[model samples]
Target: MIDETAEQLRERVAVELERARARTALLTDAVDDDDLIRQHSPLMSPLVWDLAHVGNQEELWLVRDVGGRDPVRHDIDELYDAFKHVRADRPQLPLLGPAEARGYVATVRDKVLDLLGGVPFEGRRLTTDGFAFGMIVQHEQQHDETMLATHQLRVGPAALNAPPPPPAGARVAGEVLVPGGPFTMGTSTEAWALDNERPAHVVDVPAFFIDAACVTNREYARFIAEGGYSQPRWWSEDGWRHRMEADLTAPMHWQRDGDGWAYTRFGRTEPVNPDEPVVHVCCYEAQAYAAWAGKRLPTEAEWEKAARFDPATGRSRRYPWGDESPSAHRANLGQRHLAPAPAGAYPDGASPLGVHQLIGDVWEWTSSDFVGYPGFAAFPYREYSEVFFGPKYKVLRGGSFGTDAAACRGTFRNWDFPIRRQIFSGFRCARDAEPV
Candidate 1:
């Protein structure tokens, strides 16, 4: 993306926008209209709600905000306002039917494509490098990931499919050392980076050792076998309380199949592959597992250091592999696979210090809470990230198989409640290292 002129940015935005819409269509079109109308889970919006909501956002940002056009459907703006309705109550509203939602989104996208042809990219911060357009692309992609999770939560058979990722053929080490010192922690240069990841600043991190690959199902099973959940010592007071209240005995979708454990994904039930990075484990579960293994979850700074920092260059890169961008050979991203590849897959995606799969396969939970870096300033809108900066939400780094390359980067930060296990989440362990 080097020396990308406004023209190239516009093209990139268009391609990414189309890619996102394709994915959105794939997710929404896979299921029946009844499924789309029904809320798959209380924690997620009805599929039909998501279908139209993305259109409203596109119209709000691209058609209206950037194009100075009238609202496509000003009457329904409140209906699609995410803050206005909880996921559980979304289905109760007189929501757009599946066909109507599809039509609305398509209408908005057509208008957006027209605006993209001539939108100025130099006059304002939002249009600088087509930032607003990029933001909308990312928003839709993020919703695509959300809708994929909705599919996973649906009560029917698998509605989506993708080939499994590569096997963990390369024997990976247990952990890797991240040599630490003063290194830039955030990004001031990533054109599409969100407010929280902005105004890159120096962070003095100490040396630490992090899991070379994510904590796999095999590794996590050991924790479960060792009375990990029943034992309170390994869990924090809050974690133990929640574990008991939620009756969380294992990762979501996992159950005891005769002679071994089985996992269900997208309605397919199969024996859990021990080598795959464990998914659906919340922050508390990840933290407890780390404690059970005598390790700890990496801080956001440590995770980023292990991910983007290169000792030789003494600088940060856009991704683990490099500033170039994600590819199938580099990382498992863009929903190319339905689930995480076996641990140790994607050796090419490893960080310079030999930290593998740092960018994708699963969203690795960090020990850090969601907070803005120093000198952070909200641009375009404060609701994007400013409203969520608190100790309540834990930050997760890296992307998942469902995460699009256009939306995820080393500086891209994701956060959720610690007890929410419905998302595609996982973890890698880390610990302090003695000075060499």
Candidate 2:
């Protein structure tokens, strides 16, 4: 195992914290106060609320929890407490304006950085391994993603832009077979892994065939052309109800234009690219597409096994491409493209079994509910994961282009309601392997 020294770890933590702050700035700086305070959708907090909430969390964890300092702004704690206020109601609260929010986070960050320089690296799980620092960075980056979602939902002109992802290389047609076997499912030793992914365990999975790449716009278009939305047989009862109630004809921001499809992305309207992964799709949509294709969404176990299990080594890797960490060439991440790379774009990032784009491009919905593993225990707080353990939420594996590497891992778990389509989400299908 590679040993990271205290200084090395501290520098790494500092860099990640700064990167998170930079992303936050990039997302917020491009918008005006009106955009910041306005709630784009009932499901999301006002951008200003997220801005202040980021500071409040950093102050709570680093300034108060780790530093043992008095509260910086005790009066506003209730205002920014996420559990205390729902997204729709946040705009009604007296949130700090954009300038004030930026100043508040800056002050909080300065103190946190100071504390981090001297914090011991050997005591208390929260402080040890620089977990508190890492957690703060992850928290900020998550809010960055949420803010980006807000941007996507906003009605204004494009507020952000990046060069397009490199053109996809040769497409690997068809599915890869994951041999039947038990493989490590989660992580017991990933220092910064969240509570939900803790205490790695082995899971025995039957042989299955999973898509080599995420289902793309071209593939999904076939479902639409085949009257996927009109066919009740392809959708679950609840899923069909939600679809009918919403009257969704295509994925969010999509519309039939003449004989083709057009989509609004980051406030720009363009023809749908057939080769890119189909994103902004809800789990219900994924399920419907899978059903239409005579396949199924891979279960969480099957998805993880395909991404991490190595047949030759009989061990699991930290990432699909053997754990070396993500880069521009390996995966499309960190809002580098503001969109998914074309399907089959990152051959270098394929999993041991040659499953491509498993780490990035988009968050792939899985056919599993959000639940705790056996022997699970809530850490630091229960609200993080314990409270959400149930069938009410569906799981999404892998990370999206907006995801930070610090917060993403093979074991990282993301969950949401089955009907949520505003996130950057997509899916790849799977099926039982045929008997020899």
Candidates' TM-scores?
0.99, 0.99
Clashing pairs in 2: none
**Which lDDT tens digits does candidate 1 get at residues 133-155?**
88888999999999999999998
Candidate 2 Cα lDDT to native: 0.91
Over 298-323, each residue of candidate 2 has an lDDT whose tens digit, in order, gives: 99999999889989999999999997
lDDT of each: 0.91, 0.91
The true-versus-predicted C-alpha distance at residue 405 of model 2, in Å, is 1.1
